[model samples]
Each structure stands twice: as C-alpha cells, then as structure tokens.
Target: MSPRSASVNEELRRRSRERLLQATVELVGERGYEATTLADVADRAGAARGLVSYYFPGKRQLVQSAVHRLMHLTLAAALDREPRTDDGDERLARAIDAVLGLTRTHTTVMRTHMALILQHEGFIQCPEQQKLAALLEDTIARWGAADPGQDYRLLRALLMGAVVALLLPGAPMPLSSLRAELFQRYGLAWESGCPPNDEPPPRS
Candidate 1:
C-alpha cells in the first residue's frame, strides 16, 4: 500500500487529538478532576499515551482544552437547533441557555474547568477557546451591541459568573435565576431560548 498523503496524515492527527479531548471530558466527568489522569484519558480515547502529551502540554491544559471543545460544540448545536432564527434576541437567548445548560448537565467537568481557570494558569487561548469566543462575539454582535468587542467581554464575564454560581460547592445557585438575569440584561422575553418550566430560578 502507498504511504499516507499529507492530507491523510493531517486528518489522522486531528482525529487523534479529538479523541483525546473527548476522552478527557468523559473521564473527568466520571471520575472527578483529581482522579482522572492523562493515562486514563489516553486509554479511554484508545490512543497512545504519548499522544496526549503531544496534543497537550500537561493534564491541566488538556482538561481545559477538552472542556472548551465541549462548550464550543454545545453552543454550536444550540445556535443550529431546529426552527433556527435570525433574530438576534432569539440567538442570544439560545447561546445563554446553551452555556448555562452545560453547568447543569456537565456539572463535574464544568466545575473542574472553572476551578482550573481560577488558578494561576488562567484562560488558555487554545483553538477551542478561540472558537467559543468567536461564537459568543458573533452572538453579541447579532444582538445589536453598541460595541461587540466590549459587549463580548461583558457577556463573557456574566456567563462566567453564572457558571461559578451554579457550580459553587455546598451552596450552588439556581440556573433559572442566572438565566433570568441574563435574559433581563439582554432584553429578552422570558419564553425565549430553552426557557425553564413555570417555576423560576430562585433569587439569592
């Protein structure tokens, strides 16, 4: 058989990286942050252990990138959900709900991710994070922000605060409340974007 072409090799490399990222998400979600190791991620990914080191500088960076990828995929899905609308209000609502939803469903993974970000490492400007930023910035622009650049930072700050509230240990806040606050800030209707049931998110 002929040797693999450059494009084929690139595709294979991409797949390996993606597999490792996905595996990290799954393992960390299952076993918590401290318990899950890069070796475990490699095993779950069915890739060589060394491949994890190649794709990520360390386990910390690996988990962060994995979570970012998960967030990007999730926000993308929400944006593309059926009955998609061009209305900025609707799109922004979906974007907010999509991220807040992750805090609820992927609580463990997200909690670990948020905690890591708080440490000295801070935000790692990986490809996955850049994708997330682009989606949010575009969403803010669509919402008719006076300045997307400024609004994007503001929206990001709000969402980060909401996630921290949702994941706070022993005293977690309600997602509904966070969602309501975001909707109010964005001038969105209560019924928009994967709205919660009749019961509202409790106020602190």
Candidate 2:
C-alpha cells in the first residue's frame, strides 16, 4: 500500500482524537466521572489505550474537553437550526437555551464539567473551550453589544450561574425560574427561544 499523504495522516489523527473525546462524554454521562476511566474511554472509542494519554494528559482533561466539545456543538446546532435568522435577540435567546438545555439533558456530564471548572485547575483551555468561547462572543456581538468580549464574559458568567443554580445539590431551583431570570436579564420575551412551558414561573 502507498504511504498516506500528510493531509490524510492529519485527518486520521483528528478522527481518532474526536472518537476519544466522544467516548469520554458517553461514558462519563452514563457512569459519572469517577466511575469512568481512561482505559474505558479508549475501549469505547476503539482506539489504543496509549492514544488517550497522547491526546489528553489525564481523564479529567479528556472529560473536560469532551464536555466542551458537546457544549459548542449543541450551541452551534441551536444557532443554525431551521428558520435560522440574523436577529440578535433570537440568536442570543437560542444561545441561552442551548447552554441551559444541557443541564436538563446531560445532567451528569454538565454537573461533572461544572465541578471540574470550579476547582483549583479552572478551565482546561483546550481548543474545544476556545470554540465554545468564540461562539458565545459571536452571539453577544449579534445581540448588539458594544464590546463583544466584555459582554461575552458577562453572558458566560450568567449562564454558568444559571447552570450551577439548576444543578445545585439538595436545593436545586426550577429550570423555568432560572430561564426566566436569564430572559429578563437580556430583555427577552417569554416566548423567545425554546421555552419549557407556556406561562412564565411566578415571581415573589
């Protein structure tokens, strides 16, 4: 067989790495972070055990990247879904719902991700995280922010706070309440984005 071209080799490597990340997400979501190991992720991805270490220093980093990839992919799909528009309000609303939706749909993954990020290590600073940040910055820019960078930070903080609230142990708040607070902060209508219910939750 002929030797693979440089581009082909790179593409193969990318696919391998992607599989590992995906496997991490699935295993972690199904079994929680501690229960899932690097060997298990590699086995699930059908890649070599050493490849996991080559792509990620450890299981925590791997899981973090996987979750970040999930976040960016979910946000991208929501923003580009059918009937897509350039309207700032709609785009911002979609972004908010997309992130918030993860808490409900992937509770284990999101909770683990949030806990890791809050630890001393902070963000993993991987490419997946960069992509997620870029998407959020674009959303803020579309939403008429004079300073997209600053506004993106604020939006990120708000979203993180909401996720923490929704995932809080023993005293978790209602998703609708958190969503309503976010919509109110951005001056969005209750009907915007994918509202969980018809009427907004009553406020005190």
Candidate 3:
C-alpha cells in the first residue's frame, strides 16, 4: 500500500492531539488535578502512555490546554446557539452569558483552572488559549467598542474577575447577581441571551 499523504498524516496527528486534550479535560474535571494522572488521561483517550508527554509537557500543561479548548468551544457554541442574532448588544450579552453559565455548570473544573492560572505557573500560552482570546476580542468588537483593542483587555479582565468571584470558596456570589451587574454594565437588557429562569434584577 502507498504511504499515507502528508495531509492525511497531519489530520491524524490533529485528531490524536484533540483526543488527548479532551481526555485531559474529562479526567481532570471529573477527578480533580492530583487524582488524575497522565497515564489515566492517555488510557481514557485510548492513546499510548508515551503520547501524553509527547503532546504535553506535563499534566498541568495538558489540563490547562484542555480546559482552554473547552472554554473556546463553550463560548463559540453560546454565540451561535438557538435564536441567533448579529446585533451587537445581543452578541455581547450572549458572550457574557456563555462564560457566566460555565461558572454554574463547570464550577469545579473552572475553579481548578483559575487556581492554576493565578497561583502557579501563570498563563499557559497555547493555540487554544489564543483562540479563546481572539473570540473574546471579536466579541468586544462586535459590541461596538470604540477602541476594541483596549476594550478587549478590559473585557477579559472583567470576565476573569467575575469568574474568580463566582468561584470564590465559602463565599461564592450568585450567578444571577453577577449576570445582573454585567448586563447593567454593558447596557444589555436582562432578557437577553437565554436568560436565567429567575426573576429579573430590579431596576434602579
């Protein structure tokens, strides 16, 4: 049989890497960081144990990349979810909801991811992270930022802060409250973007 083409080989590699990343997310999120080992992730991915280190420097790095990929995919889906729109306000609202919604559903995973980012090795620079950043930047631009470049940074910081706040242990704030503040800040109507099934925040 002829050797596989270069493109085919590249596609295989991409699939392998994606499987590893996804396995990391599932294992780490379900089992927490320390409990989940590289071997476990490899096994879960049905990949060779050696392939783990070949794809990622360590479990921490692997988990970070995986979580970032999750974040990117989550946000993307929210932006294009049912009842989609191109309106700047609605898009921005969707972006906010997408992220804040994660705080509710993926609390444990995101808490661990944030802790690693804040207290440990700092931001892991990977293509997945860059993609997440680019999408957020685009969200800010779509929101009609007068200076999207600057506003993107601000938006990122705010989202990070909100996540940290939402995940704060023993004193975690309410997602509804955080959503209220974000909506108010961006002049977004409370009814926007698959709004929660709770009462609307009171008007000033």
Cα RMSD for candidates in order: 2.3, 2.1, 1.9
Give per-model TM-scores: 0.94, 0.95, 0.94
Q: Write the per-residue lDDT of candidate 1 for residues 15-98, one digit (tens) a residue.
A: 999999999999999999999988999999998899998889998999999999999999999999999788999999999999
Task: Give the candidates in order of TM-score, highest first.
Answer: 2, 1, 3
| Tens-place lDDT digits, model 3, residues 1-204 | 336687788889899999999888887768888899999988999999998889788877888899899899998998888787888899889888888888878877899899999989787999899999999989899889999889988988888899999999999987788888888999999888868887566656
lDDT for 192 (candidate 1): 87
Tell me the tens digit of each residue's lDDT in model 2 across 1-204. Answer: 345687788899999999999998899889999999999998999999999999888877898999999999999999999898999999999999999999989999999999999984888999999999999999999999999999999999999999999999999988888888888888888777888865465574
The TM-score between candidate 1 and the true structure equals: 0.94
Question: Comparing candidate 1 with candidate 3, which one achieves the higher lDDT?
Answer: 1
Give the whole-model CA lDDT for all candidates, comma-separated: 0.91, 0.91, 0.87
Lowest summed lDDT window (length 10), candidate 2: 195-204
